[model samples]
Target: MITRETAGELLARIPVSVPDQPEGESPTAVKASPFTGAERRVMGILTVPKWQQGMDQGVLPRAYQDILDVVRDAPGPVRAKQIAPRIGLPAETSKIEGVRSKLKRLVERGWLDEGTPGLFTPSHAWTANSAKSP
Candidate 1:
């Protein structure tokens, strides 16, 4: 219920104390690169999709390529489900289904050639011979 003149006098009575900071240490000084170890860990978590996409080339999943190298090197067609475990996926019902979904997409994208229904081989066009072809 204080009047404006009284309020101003009361506010003027309060004093603000700010400690004197040393002038030598700059608040905006250039520190070390923020990309050092701990920050890299944070960025690594953020960039996983980009990293995975680079590994996948947008067609195969990261999980597939881990096993694809083995499958593609095999003499004959390799079944999609068979590659799941070697790529670290569980062979159990639900997880296998997820792996199968990605494998089917890889097959459809021409990144893999489905030799027999579920059996796959890498497309020769994606191989070393790609340079030789038109």
Candidate 2:
């Protein structure tokens, strides 16, 4: 009888068909199989790392890094509404709220500081630590 591991291996080896490509695309182009072993492992890994002194900002996912960069460059503490447009997001209420949520996450992770309600700035620990590096 096939065990669960054997069944999973069989399923992962199956090639999935690609949908029609856009115009100018070669029909003979090879498509990668969906849910390959390596891809599955990567997808399961956590994207964020908790802030620690000497830990580079590169550890963050791109979206989180962009938010941190914008806050760090600002003249002073900034609001999510002001940050959204700078980060390529529309300055609408929904988008601002989404940015606000990410900002809050950064605060919780110790990457940023909230000196006043709805205002954010880079954490002193992060700035001081990063500045000490080359």
Candidate 3:
């Protein structure tokens, strides 16, 4: 997982500057996405970014790992909801929303694959341990 400090370091190298305000009267005020094509390419490589800060404080139980293990060996794409229960979270309002949150990050890191919406599957990059059981 990338740390906040790491994200800041990579972002600093880009030519663009971060602004203090989201919207301002000045024409030169920075926009959310001030980067050009080149910057986007660099940003893509940064997987965790500052969002990792949240995970550091979040609670992740062994069940979560089991869920990933289950999906890893699925014959085909799996749904996010299906994996949720395997981790002991069967609904969105479960106590451990962190499970859901980390799943999103995993998807972003290319450790898992996503489809139309709620569907997901393990990415090829996952090791055999992450695969499903027979």
- Predicted structure with the largest TM-score when compared to the true one: 2
Instruction: Write down the lDDT that model 1 would get.
Output: 0.57
Tens digits of per-residue lDDT for model 1, 105-130:
66654556777787777765555443
Which runs in model 3 stand beyond 4 Å of their true positions? 1-64, 90-92, 95-98, 127-134
Better lDDT candidate (2, 3): 2
Which residue pairs overlap in candidate 1's backbone?
Answer: none
TM-score of each: 0.47, 0.67, 0.40
Name model 1 segments beyond 4 Å from true.
1-61, 129-134
The collision pairs in model 2 are none
Against the true structure, what is every candidate's RMSD? Answer: 17.1, 11.4, 14.2
Give the Å error, residue 17, model 1. Answer: 43
Q: In model 1, which range of ten residues has the least summed lDDT?
A: 46-55
Question: Per-residue CA lDDT of candidate 2, range 1-134, in tens?
Answer: 46767867877897765587667767577466432222213233545555876677787778888999999999999999999999999889999999999999889878999999999999999999989999
lDDT of 2 at 51: 80
What value of lDDT does candidate 2 attain over all alpha carbons?
0.81
Of candidate 3, the 10-residue stretch with the lowest lDDT total is: 49-58
* Per-candidate local distance difference test: 0.57, 0.81, 0.53
Q: Pick the candidate with the highest lDDT.
A: 2
